[model samples]
Every structure is written in C-alpha cells, then in structure tokens.
Target: MSIVFEPVRGRPNSGGRLTVGTLYYGDARYPIRIEDRALAHLKIVILTKLRRNESFALSWEKKPADGSGRGTVWIHPALSFHFEFSGSKEPEINMAWLEKMSESANRTLGLRIDDEPREGEADPAAARAGV
Candidate 1:
C-alpha cells in the first residue's frame, strides 16, 4: 500500500521565488514540501549520517495551516530520498546552520529543523574572508 501526502495548500507557479519543492521518501509515496534552500542543506546532513549507516528519527512540527500537528519518520540507509527542486539555480549554504543541524542529528531525538544561527556565527572562514 502507498500513502499520499498533499500540501496544505496549492503552491503558486509565479516562477522564481514562488515555487516550493518536494522531498520524497518512502518509495516516493510520501512527499514533504520544503523550500529548495533549506532542503539542500538538510540533504547534506541527512546523507552524512546515512552514509555512516546510522538510523534515526526525524521529526517536524506541522504548520498551523497544515493542521498544527507533528510528524516523525525513521530514516535508515535502506530508505530512498528524492529531492525535487523547482528552481534551476542552487541556493547558497550557511555553514553555521549545517553545524548546528549536525549537532542535533547526533542527539537522542534525532534531527529537527532548527533556525539558522545569527550573524558572526554563520561561517568563521567565510566571515574572515569578508564574504
């Protein structure tokens, strides 16, 4: 049997900034809407743990529009993940966000999408380089 997940509301096709992408898991039957920029960074951290053969639970709080609940999934190396981006260009990454997320993924509760750290904590090298 397959489970289907629909977005809380239809996304507009205004091009560029209006598009919302999907992260498909569980044999592509389960779909989660995520912005390209955030999803890109998430993919990096998730893949790292999976590459090490680690299995963990990933939980996310649902938005108010999405019924205001929570969802959790057990991610294992055996499962597949397909990230479908709506835009052609890749978004810039924040190293500090990656570091914070990596730390969370290592914890007992597993990965939770955390907010990006404030300035000065973003990237030490990039900051020094005046980027």
Candidate 2:
C-alpha cells in the first residue's frame, strides 16, 4: 500500500475547500482525509523542512487496524513533490503543533503523527506492540 495525504487550510472559515492536494506515493495516490487542522499542521512542518533541503521521515497511523503497523516515508527536496490547494486563502495555522512536529523532524527519530498532538504520545514501538 502507498501513503497519501491531503493538504488543507485550517478551520473556522466559511469556504468549503475539501482538498488541497493529493499526495502520491509511488504509482498509487490516496486522498488525505485527515481533519483540516491536522493536515494544516503537517503541511507547515513538511514545507519548512523541505525548504531547508532537509530530509526526514514522516510516520502516520494506518486505518482499519489491519495489524500491518504505521506508515512512514522519507521526504526530501529532490522528490517530485506537489501540493494543490483549492482555495486562495491560507488556512488557520497551529503554531504549537507545527513547532512540535518541527522539533521531532529535527531529531534523529524524525516526525511521527499525533492526530491530536496533545492527546497521546507518539511511540511507534508502543503502537506496534499493541497490535
């Protein structure tokens, strides 16, 4: 399976921009159904790292709890990256989450997804052990 995510602006707006972009992996493409807030946070982290020519790992939980574990990808500036936005207005920004994710990316472990950044810890080993 391939990993994909949609980039969207943050909430609290009247615009109905459903999807910002289709993140493609290999030959497969999947819609990024994550909430707008989380997606916005992710986009900021990704762009900041890539803009500096830094490569890091991005990990996220997989749906359906199929026992396969979480998904991770190494993001680099050289990759064929693209983000399509449906609206001209920028979404609301979550600075705290972006800072946290940025700090994680700068670490050796890279960035791990916390759908709700304040809700739980991001431990891949713990997640795998649970399954």
**Top of the candidates by lDDT:** 1
Misplaced by over 4 Å in model 2 are 1-21, 25-33, 65-68, 85-89, 117-131
**TM-score of candidate 2 relative to the true fold:** 0.61
The digit string of per-residue lDDT tens for model 2 on 8-121 reads: 223434555454334543333554344445556677888888788889987776555333457767788877655545555566665555766777888887886553434344
Q: Using TM-score, give the best candidate's number.
A: 1
Kindly list the per-residue Cα lDDT of model 1 for residues 1-131, writing each as its tens digit.
21223323222234634455677877755588776666677889989999999988877877766677778788899988888887677766778777767878888898877655555554745666899
RMSD of 1: 5.9
lDDT of 1 at 40: 72
Backbone clash tally for model 2? 2
CA RMSD per model (angstroms): 5.9, 8.3
lDDT of 1 at 51: 92
